[model samples]
Target: MNVELRQVHDSDLPVFYRQMNDPESLRMAAFTPKEPADRDAFDAHWAKIRSSDAVVRTVLADGDVVGNAAVYGVPGEREVTYWVDRAYWGKGIATAALRALVTEVPERPLYARAASDNAGSLRVLEKCGFRTVATASGYANARGAEIEETVLLLEG
Candidate 1:
């Protein structure tokens, strides 16, 4: 798949909304909104992020809107995040999309987090050059419990 990243388009919001609600994907992500079904809240959150200066983009695979990747938060504390459709899991789309996003932004010291148990996601982050910096436990809405989370960083 020709995975690439591009500015998030107005039409991509609906696609992202659907992808966010996938039960499997949510489970893998762990840290998610408590009310994933609340369209109003979802819209509000997206509106804020899209309106902000965050480096957000729609992930495309062979020209299809497959997911999203972004770098957000305070300048020195910025973090990198990405989601690949569950169907594309293990296909390297997430890794490619994240690398592309980092390249486009060209700002470093990026942070990332993943459910400690999500090997696929952790591997993707590691492959993208994010080193494990710490491990912490947090309430995971998707898991409905406090779980171990891995914190990673890519230094400039």
Candidate 2:
């Protein structure tokens, strides 16, 4: 797969919405919107991010939009995040997308968090040079309960 990242286009929102609503993907992601099926809220969230200083990008593979990657938050405390279509899981797309996102930002101390049980995401973050710094519990809307989350950091 030729994984790459590019500025997010208006046409990509619907694709992202569908990908994000996958039941399995939502469970794995854990920390997601309270209502993943709420189109209005989803659009509102995307609009907020797009208008902010967030560095958001669409992840493409072989010229097809496969997911999204972004780095958002205040400087010195920005966090990196990515979501690859479940169909593309286990194919190195997430790691590649994350690597590309970090490269574009060129900032250090990027942070990430993943459901502790989500080894795949943890592995992807680690592969992209993020190190586990701590573990905390948070309300996972998808899981409908509090769960352990692994905090990771990438520092120069």
lDDT of 1 by residue, 3-70 (tens): 98888888998899999999999999999999998999999998999999898999999999999999
- Model 2 per-residue lDDT tens digits across residues 48-110: 999999999999999999999999999999999899999999999999999889888888989
The local distance difference test score of each candidate is 0.92, 0.96
* Native-referenced Cα lDDT, model 1: 0.92
Please provide TM-scores, in order, for all candidate models, with all chains considered together.
0.98, 0.99
In model 2, residue pairs whose N, Cα or C atoms come closer than 3 Å (at least 3 residues apart or on different chains), thus clashing, are: none
How many backbone clashes are present in model 1?
0
Q: Could you tell me which 10 consecutive residues in candidate 1 have the lowest summed lDDT? A: 100-109
Q: What is the lDDT of residue 103 in candidate 2?
A: 85
